[model samples]
Target: MSGPAIEVDDLHKRYGDLQAVAGVSFTVERGEFFGILGPNGAGKTTTLEMVEGLREPDSGSVRLLGESPWPRNPRLLPRMGVQLQASAFFEKLSAREQLQTFGALYGVPARRVDEMLELVGLSDKASTREDRLSGGQRQRLSIACSLVHDPELVFFDEPTAALDPQARRNLWDVLREVQARGTTVVYTTHYLDEAEILCDRVAIMDAGTVLALDTPAALVRGLQADTRVALPAGLLSASDARALPGVGRVQDGDGELVMSTQEPARLVQALAERDRLDGVSVRTATLEDVFLHLTGREYRA
Candidate 1:
């Protein structure tokens, strides 16, 4: 019903001899879960900073909520929430106190502070000092601080970077709840699976430019990769698998027999005919495949 919440057009930035961000452009619709995925030094953070008005772009334009983000626009500040990679909390402040201080800046009421603590699962750690909290709890506190003002658009830079798997999943639930409340979420992550599960659409960046931009499923579909079907070891020999109607490549994986084929249906039917469907597992084209196809396997600086 309204224009896009964010519109970035041909954004460019450079540092000394390095072109940090070059001609990156994309749009984020209101209430959309948009993810910027890339490896280290892919200019994801630089592009995000330019969009958040923290850095000046050498060229191009960014319209956030229909307003320019550059020059540290005061009018847009209250409407945006930014959670940087490094969390900063007031010295000696407890979790609740940290949120209280942030809420005070936005004139938010006390009840909202309680709600934020509960929302981020920080209610129990409300009295814990920032320095005394665990890495996960501190990360949650940083998120609570950014969201205490109830901004419409939230930006998170690798929010789950160093957390354990369990904590990362817990934060995923919290993020889902945030999006459920109609907040536009724009985040950057190195985890391809996480992006596929969380984002409605994603932009994959490399060498300071967008290499692929689309829904995870759409991008994977475009790759046209052969499906991989894995069967239990000792179920069939390699020669038999290779002789199947649609099987292309057969390989022996750890305790499993993996086969690749374009016509998975025909192969599966052939396996079924032989009564070898006991431990069959199928993996179709995935976001990881699409990411690698675009960004390649080279290490980034």
Candidate 2:
């Protein structure tokens, strides 16, 4: 395979005595939609800022498309697009005017502004002042401004935060369209399901440390041995269920029993032989389960 589009080696950052990012390292391949997932204050934003050349790391290094991120290289700036967690704009500027200003900075043609507005579903709002737009509409405009330069790579930080479900879905579709065009994306969000659906691979981070890195399917498979199988009532007690073939653990709850095992198929067949199984349901491991198993806590907490 070709070298990574983005690479970091033992990346570290500090805020006074606090070590915000501690030796985190990962690589994002070209055209890959990579996600960085973590709870609040997990150093996710700090890490991304360092990668985007907005902040200097206290130690370690970052390489963006084989070039150093520091010193804010002018040539590299136009090739990258960034949408911060919190964005600001001239409140008096209309959407079209704002896009025009940024377009001039990148030396892009004025026509590109209208194209991006349409791409992000903000064309109708082009004449609206930034302050008059709703939060979701402003976010869409921010995304549109980021793409006015037609960058090859984009960094989206919590792009769906604070939006209603419908608006969030709209943004998700827009992002899908961006990816379909072969532009690489590095996304950071608290939404695990979004990451699962949109990202080709992800790196789970906490307290500046990388807990896991892999495709969502591969990460979930690592917990396959802890798979759960739920069986219906009057079937088996906890102890008897544990004694069943391939059953590693079993817990009875009223009319239902949840059995955890490395070999669910064997347990199912064994239970079937005794006529003790009814309405059985097997749940394969999921990304959320892997996050909880590895971190011993909920993701949003």
Candidate 3:
């Protein structure tokens, strides 16, 4: 509470010969909506578990709310909440019943349970059994259970992993509202678009190390990645596209001409001057571009 809500230093975790997390360190400011992004098996879950006190690191240290998370600190338990990537619920329990059960575990009052169910927009389905709820509803119930105690800091691991597009957006709105109320949130996901839209700052991780950490806009801009221009195949020869003002790289693939440029307006003007603007469209670089730049195109586990 006085310093960073979460602090990790020289963290290392090894599973036999496989090093899941290696010498990682970072700080999460109080009340900041932070994101940890990486592909599967990038040690994201391992790192988070260590911070949440769910797993002890082989080496290094973690402090949650200024107290050590290892050895199962009881004081931190009351001040923190976590929603795992996958959660199992008692199928026979109603939405309201489930939250009440979790609330009792933390000595939360019955009023708090009701508040949480309504906060996650599950009020109308409060009586529905867990097994009868939709996937999105179950997810919301998971979130509601995590917050039933009103913990100051919350952690979510891939909270929207398998949700439909509409459900994802709806949950996003719920998260935004949570941030508005001043609770610090740490979220992890491989979804670049979600991190870009939801997090105030993101740490990009790969191979058990953080490759980059900053605001999504700053990270993407720091790469100096070019704005991409796409055109129909044969709209202009590859040579002509490459020769265009401000263009940097030209790639011809699948009957389309794609090129990168720093100056989209200038390139557009030049193409228009040549009467070659048809089928041309420009797109700005995104966090996905930054991720690929840092981690390379190779697939990871």
Q: lDDT score, residue 175, model 3?
A: 92
Off by over 4 Å in 2: 1-3, 231-257, 264-282, 298-301
lDDT (0 to 1) per candidate: 0.93, 0.86, 0.90
Query: For candidate 3, lDDT tens digit of each residue in 69-127?
Result: 88999999889889987898876999999998898898888888778877899989999
Residue 258 lDDT in candidate 1: 97
Better of 1 and 2 by TM-score: 1
Tens digit per residue, CA lDDT, model 1, 86-130:
988899999999999999998999999999999999899999899
If the candidates were sorted by their lDDT against the true structure, best first, what order would they fall in?
Answer: 1, 3, 2
TM-score of 3: 0.91
TM-score ranking, high to low = 1, 3, 2
The parts of candidate 3 lying over 4 Å away from their true place are: 232-243, 251-256, 269-280
- In candidate 1, residue 119 scores what lDDT? 97
Per-residue lDDT tens digits for candidate 2, residues 151-207, read: 888999999998888888889999998888778899988777788888999998888
Task: For model 2, state the Cα shift of residue 78 in Å.
Answer: 0.6
Clash counts per candidate, in order, are 0, 0, 0
TM-scores for all candidates: the values are: 0.97, 0.84, 0.91
Which candidate wins on lDDT? 1
Query: Residue 91's C-alpha lDDT in candidate 2?
Result: 65
